[model samples]
Target: MASQTDDTDRITVRLAGREHRDWTTYRIDSHLITPADAWQVTLGIPADALPDTVKPWAAVDVCLGQDVVLTGRIDRIEREVAKGTNALAISGRDGAAVMVDCSAPIFTRRKATLTEVVDLAVRPLGVSQVRVEATGAKEKVEIEPGMTAWDALAQACEANGCWAWFEPDGTLVVGGPDYTAAPVATLVMRQSGQGNNVLSLAVTEDVSGRYSEVTVLGQAHGTETTDGQHNIKHQETDADVPGYRPLILVAGDCDGAAEAKRRAQKTLMDSRLEGFTITARVRGHRVSESGKPWTPGQRIQVVSEPHGLDATYFLMARTFLGGRDKGSITELTLKEDGVWLPELAKISGGKGKGKAASAGKVVELS
Candidate 1:
């Protein structure tokens, strides 16, 4: 009893050097971000239906139509037997798991750019494919001891104000969220059996962590002869919010006032972006505007009067579920427009290796 869309949707399972076709698939949850980009498949089978050839650690490939949505290895399998019925569950992670699990040691003489650091970190792992965005400018950076490739990648991304994730085809993509595109669809809550196609929606707004003023204190270097002291310069920035909610940051590596100001401004922008979020559950698989499946980093228009919210947001995370009863549902978590940090320099401060406490400033140098 498969619907037209269901007939078109397919999942291909490969195990023990063999392909299992026409297997019943229950649910699929996948994302474009690390750790969250995983999938699960459930099949109705009789007791002892699983053959010995089907084992964990087997390679898996999931497809929607002709497009390969996930390329990974099977992590685990669960079997249930009850009420004269039985079922088998299989789950696995995307290719990024290799990067997340591999251990790597990277070093640079004096300094290197964010792009260079990232290239060095991943070169050791030998990922087959990548789509790294152009990250202009070099910055002084350090990789802490005993850091995994995943940790190093995260640090590089945070410093460059960009994000990285694995594509369904196992290509690692590093870039910033883009908002110039128009929204894919507009969601409006309506009465039962009305015009609304949404299943569930929730909006959140928090001002507790917001700050109206941000101050970044940087390194104090050689001072003027008049005072015969170290030169110390600080920078302050303002947020758009009302009242005075102040945040202070210390940049041990910050070279001067200009660098300090950049850090303060970036911090304020990050805090403001994280101040609010929207979570929604929608029916169907494709967006009305694009006629394509929902994907992370896409723009969408959301309207809900009860929550007093009417705004456009960027999809930060999503989970797609499809099965016999509910058909298909897409759960989404969105962030406001200003939250993307494409070209901005990031702030990093902490104890690092080699250099004296002072050599490594409180703020990272760009």
Candidate 2:
């Protein structure tokens, strides 16, 4: 039988049973329970404070008057759905009957084992690496004897550079890219001058993964340069170049210098100058030079409204040239709109001159 003595305390009969013995204890609370019928129970203990001896699925007995009721293992402690008060749900073992929504608060379960904790923590990081904390009171346990899944998960993240956090709605957040970490491969492109004459160069390294292709995008212009002997050098020209557009470079093999020209050709054709008048000097020779008696590679300069830069001319010559030679490809961009004219302009004629012209010439895109 249950009875109340004062406003803050009450006496209730509690029965705990096992296979061999049964015992009863008197339960008391700080506040008097009204009608002694329905009231909430709370164990004001931190999750970590509980002992490790408690099993995940252990049961305790509860007996009230002539009616005998049983409560099973504690799954978790949650706030009351309606009143927002702390409450617990005792789950029964296999084939065992248990009561739901009990009024009195019962005992709290122990913390999870060390093994359980570690397992939960390592699950999300994948099997790449493992790092354990060296200093901390919690770190003392090589393996937590009894820890919850959540606790293990948190620890694993701290060790493996991975972490989980809750969103505003209590949703879990996980994996993100590490931008500071260097990429496995890089594709570098360089341009020496401005407008249509801007030289475009490309190189690739450390690319182990399967990527179909790479691209470089920028404006091109037409210009001329003369050597000490007064030889004229022609450059790429474009009438209408957009502020920004993507250029795509595709090739069969990413290895060796032969692929550099292929990639460069793709860049010229895919750039904003696709439909603009342009001339390309690929692999140290002009496009119009190819197939000519004096020219080793083709050096075809065209003024067609939207002629895509010729890729075959550049790629084939570059393959034959071989190595990391600097004289691979040079493109020029036009500053003003006009008909094509040939003049011996110096290579170092821009505002920034020698240094600035070399800045973006060989930028690695990947």
Candidate 3:
């Protein structure tokens, strides 16, 4: 009976238009920076219970309850036999898998809008739904040979201090978190063991790649007719870095001094991301208060006096696990808030297409 209940749990996977559950083992992994969400499931059953039509490359939809969470295609399948019972396992990635695996459509665009770049990179892969919520000025970018679709899209978005990720329904979204939205749930780790919902909270702090100061230098031409600038530099300091460890990088190119500052700030944030992370393990797969799965890019309040931690964090990754041997578990990977948004400049005036003044330099490659 317990095994039957486990197989009929709320999570289900639809393949080839047929919903399937009763999984003997399952794992789902999703991340904010990763292009694709991945999932795997295995089952041991009589050979007759297996579907002959279910094969690799078949379209799949993963869902919790009635809401879909992932739209992807199967990548691999394995079959094994032991003691006259056959076990079948399959693994796959979401729509962005193609972007990560295939080369981008080669193109050189002049003064390209962010949305345009995203469409150019993903549409060829049969992903026509793309949204760019993060604001940025029209950029002159060249997507040369050998770049993957994901690389091209990420480069254009990251240059503007934004990121590209897929929505549950397979729409590509280019934006940062909506900081104004309220936190969905609070994880309390009280020393008194009262009102605590957290099963385990682990904090990791490493300073190996962290630094107090970051300098970014670049060179670039202003426009088609204007002269290019050289030696454009910007430096940003991180008060969080307790010691004076400086790092400098030569940025390949910059739109101006403004872009230089943005680059420097992004570097500093990257250091912060590397320096600290919080991992929380909790019972069940959904947020208690919201009834929704714990999702990446959401804000979560964490109060743990034992670790001297009392701040909201950005959920950057989440994983769900459950099988015959274990109950449902959700593991959350979080980072300090506001560090994910890189704060790149956006164009203003005249439909947000106007170019800002060049403040830095764009370095040329030899």
TM for candidate 3 is: 0.87
In candidate 3, which residue pairs clash? 219-361, 219-362, 219-363, 220-361, 220-362, 254-362, 256-359, 256-360, 257-359, 257-360
Q: Write the per-residue lDDT of candidate 2 for residues 1-366, one digit (tens) a residue.
A: 123223111111232322211112121111000111111123323334333333344433322222222223333333333444333222222101111122112123324323333333333322123333222313212224344334444443333323343211112333221222211211122232222432333222121221223342222222376222222221222222333333343333232232344334323322321232223333322232232111111222212112222111111111111111222232322111111111111121211122112211122223
Model 3 over residues 1-366: C-alpha lDDT tens digits? Answer: 011123323568887657777678889898988778999988887767767657887888888767777888899999998787788898999999999999878655444456766767778888878887776546646676778888888878776667889888888888877654567899989889999998899988898998888888898767879888898999888765678999988877777788888778777777777777889999988888978888897778777878876666678899988876678888999876656663532211111010101101111111
TM-score list, all predictions:
0.77, 0.14, 0.87
TM-score-better candidate, 1 vs 2: 1
Worst 10 residues of 3 by lDDT: 351-360
Span of ten consecutive residues with least summed lDDT in model 2 = 28-37
Among the numbered candidates, top TM-score falls to 3
Per-prediction tally of clashes: 9, 51, 10
When 2 and 3 are scored with lDDT, the better candidate is 3
Q: Which stretches of candidate 1 lie over 4 Å from their true place?
A: 1-6, 9-36, 51-54, 80-86, 105-112, 190-194, 220-242, 342-366
Minimum summed lDDT over a 10-residue window in model 1 is located at 354-363
Pairs of colliding residues, candidate 1: 221-231, 251-362, 251-363, 252-361, 252-362, 252-363, 253-361, 253-362, 253-363
